[model samples]
Target: MKRIIYYLTALVFACIHFVSCSDDEVEGTQALSVASFYPTIVMEGTEVTITGTAMGSVKEVVFPGGIAVSNVTCIDDRTLAVTAPAGVSEAESALVLRSENDEVASRQTIRKANPAFLSYQFADKEGAMTGSSMTINGKDLLLVEDVVFTLGDDVVSVNALEMTRKSNTAIKLVVPKDAPIGEGVQMAMSFKNNTSMTLPAIDIQKGSGGGSWVQKEVPVYSGEPVDAGSWSGSVQLAATLFADAKVDDVIRVYISDCGSNPQGSLKNGSTWVGLTDDLEYFNIGDDAANGYYERAITEEMLSQMQESGLIVAGQNYVIQKVSLFTAVWVEGGDEETTDPITPETIMLNDFEDHDGHNSSWDASWTDAEATEFPVDDNGNVYLRLAKPLDGWAINCNHQDIGTVANIENYVIKFDIKIEAGVTGASEAAMQFVLADNWLWVGAGLFPETTDGKWMTVSRNISDLSAELVGDLAIGKASNGLYGGVIPAGVCIDNLRLDPKK
Candidate 1:
């Protein structure tokens, strides 16, 4: 995440500007005319009103670059109101109002206001945690072409993946951990005119978000695939399966060929005729695809499972392999982008927040939920995609800042929770990519990680050309035939770009 901010080009203000409209009344039987919109300085995306005779006939508003916009609204016969667009070239220019037969021009040179800094707020805390969001408010911020954090001698601009222009008045970015903790840390905004302004220097504080991670995989059972003899019959895993596990540990039961609905209970010493199936009972979703069930170990659950492990009984299901994950949290902190030794990064989407970047895809078919993307009860949203199926492609639009044509030292990071029970439960190819171009990172580039837990996969992308790559895509990477691969409920989240560690 260090030196990660020097690659942005500029932010696009999204429109051609300097058009004006007003609501002043026009007298009857008057020639088609318009009054010069006052306060010639206008902000992008703000309403600009112009009062004119025959405004009811105005069909279009012409902005700078001769960009004609027909989305103007007629407030009344004598008044027209249209949102000001982002002006690219002519700072001060004449705006044209076009009707069916004639054109009316603004009597004044309406100019788009430069981005003016107002104030700034760190995350909802006294000091900003690394990976926490900070917002800067200003006027005409839509015209802010570039934003950088000046930490000491470094002028850092995050790639398009992290920064977001929320509205004309606000832009938000995630704080990086690479800065030395102290004062004189400044945020600067640059505009098209080659001018820039800086906010007041503030104290840079370190946050304790991410930390060192250590993982352990606990296998329950493994064998050739076998079908359940009956819908109500039970398959009992030995108590030793969880003998080495502890309370507060998270375990994922990997059941091979989990046909559809499955149910189970924590038994005491392999009792088939159960005493009572109460709180010990569990249900697996009707999943013809996924083969794993996740659970956090508790005092009572651990005590119950210690006797006979688990008894799973369900209809039409196959049992080939079974395993449990013993995930431990050794909390040093968010070690990836938030550790002091790591480089700075622009956070794309944690899915905890519905980031605008997620919607930047040309066509979003990420998951097939009933109506919308699934947000879990824990507030985690997911890109539930299949392997080698590269449909989860995010555009390389760096918050209107610039492309991600970056140093070879930069890496892309994302969190993937693999359901290893689902036959071919492994990540295929995740790439710093552009469609079927096969131009960037290759297949199996992820770190050696086990399934059933969220593993942060960081892949170096030095192998690709430094051209303006347009997107970052993920797919199964196997084209011809998916022998036994079915990745239905695989989850992806917290994607971003940062300098490689």
Candidate 2:
């Protein structure tokens, strides 16, 4: 009797399974339950497979933007396929599946792919360390407001200011300074309306690796590699990299390290050719300062050099390394505010050593005559600017900070003494220049140094507009206006940025 009952039950279950598979239907009003789905996120018009119990009855798939895809197909009694429709918002929302007499929505959210991050491709295909650069390639990446990395409760973010938006499909970002590290480090991109999605894990390697970016090199032509130390070859710089570089930027093509290596001849991208027909344009001149040939890189050259970079093939010159050095500026304004300054800082440059902690007053723009390092009556050494002559009156000196610079709460201190008889002693001002913005820290902002006496001047940069600076200068760069009031004989000493003590 028991065997007869078991046989009857097995026959009934087999019949129900066959009926459901053949007709793509389930018994009346069966509660649909989702087991799982592959690729919870996808690009529009991409197909997705959903698996669940009683899913054969699904007749349509409704996307977040209300596009009802009625052409859904059932693979079997427990599987269905639907292609995502276009014109849907790229955010997390319910994927509703509709059947003849039932509606089942996924318990987990589904979203359309956006900023579609393809991979963590570094320039060299390796660097994934702090301060090194990595590129995120995808569609509509401009929608990403901030890129975030998190490990447990610790979180670090790199914003748009720190990233270079190469194009609609690519963005380059240097790893943030305080980024969290370890296995299972989660990465996510923040979009508008607080929408975010979990992405593949990123490995933030330990130890020091930022050197790849700080003193990094660019690409060289491939073919016959120039004699390792030979200078008779070509160098190429990507357009997007130096397109925003300012005039007077110096490119040194040398047979040394800390720059790009000379490969073939001066050529565009891959084509072997010069940017212009001028013979002097290809003439790679020698630099006495750094023992390399230097060329003034201007916006015009950049336009032509976008693809091919500069060529150093003049007379079989065996140059090996190439470096592009940019000049940083300091700007100030006439506006002054009254606040008690709590002085603190780190020594940047004394104008005596030309070296400080990660900062230096590079003498590329001047010589010992115009900028003198003289000992005072008390044997105190100081830097002085000689009066402007018939030549360009560039009294202002530009200081170069290393790859890392002191930021907010870190104030720049300058000890200054302006000759009382100078033209604009009463209105004497200092300017800080970065990129295109100019900030002028006028008289009342610091101290009255025009009395012909050295006075310590300090400015808290935390409230300033700029976050990091490449260089700094004593005065403004106005055709010749600054040379008038800031006469030669102005003395400066003890220049540095330090934490407020």
Candidate 3:
């Protein structure tokens, strides 16, 4: 019995050696092979078959984890159909085939899910009207089957055209033609995966702030002479200064008149207009006890005066402090012009402040202050330069500040700040600019002198141009001679462009 056992063991060893040799000869190459894998493929309910070659007769094949395999049909000895497990991952799987001798295996890629319709649509503001072509930005949009879009929730009738997936992230679609223009209506988009996305509806108002930016309205009357009708009763009064203005332009306000003798008044009992806040009550026919005097108006006083009827139009007014005038004045010196009514008394502050400097001050080595564009409780702006600087030359050939237009009786106004206690003012004169056209070479005050106080400076644009519409460039030296810097450090502010009456 021992001899028989030894012989049987030797036979078993020989069989094993034969199998090993065969495997070594066919290293790395499976007798049967799976061609390729359908990566990223989605499976709904699709059948898959394995294809390869087998050396011996093939029997039944099994899938991974002992799942029942069906629809098995051998082509010859190798290629056959083995049922793929439904709802399994579309990835690598082991296939065991029972051959005539033993079982062999090769990996087959199984696709449990096939690419299907998700959802897609334009991402527009909710309540957006129809014909809105909004960008449909999303994911899983690659290789999309179809995209359905509609105005409302009902998807029965899709008004949207098929979306051509530009990439995995974006698609383009339009709001349906029949979309409503009111609220509560939404835009729905469906992707090939049967997934849907909706955008909130927006009201179809004309200007419902439908922009992506904040709105900013420029301040109109940044600084105009305090008017008699200063009290509009509302904190936000509708100002007339900036109804028509250009950017980077300065504006000014000057007090025109104080009560003249024989205090003028209509039966309305309105007091005369004054540059100052101090008021005097007098009998109808008598000169008020105090002679023509000076009275100052603090910001608080101005508010109080606004509340009283003393600030009505055409009232005889006086200057509390030496005051300035309105910014939109005529050309040339505000030299006392006849008060259209008096025709004798010169209206010192008649012209609006848009006018350029009233005079010029050359460094004759002799000059004075409060002469050209005078300032009281304020400083005057002077647009002077040493020489030609880069990107700073006076230009009036283009639109905006650089172009020349038909300007008639227009004025230019600007403000300046002087350091407190400064004594001497600068020789930097404001120009009645007329670039490319006949330049108004400091027609008014040259090197305009001031009291070294923060104030406003204005010039009549009409003095520089005959055209009713003309552009004004402020700072420029026509002579090309370099001038020394004016000791008075002045800051320019709020340049303006106003129409002249």
Counting clashing residue pairs in each candidate, in order, gives 29, 36, 83
Sort the candidates on TM-score, descending order. Answer: 1, 2, 3
Local accuracy of candidate 2 as per-residue lDDT tens digits, 292-339:
444455556676665444554544434444445442211121111111
State which candidate has the highest TM-score. 1
Worst 10 residues of 2 by lDDT: 1-10
Residue 420 local lDDT, model 1:
59
What would the TM-scores of all predictions be?
0.34, 0.31, 0.22
Model 1 steric clash total: 29
List candidate 3 segments past 4 Å from native.
1-31, 37-40, 47-68, 72-85, 90-146, 149-161, 166-501
lDDT tens digits by residue: candidate 1, 111-222: 6676667888775477655545677877766555566777767666653334532346677656655644667777677654456677777676776762332334444554
| Reference-based lDDT, each prediction | 0.50, 0.48, 0.32
Model 2 CA lDDT for position 104: 77
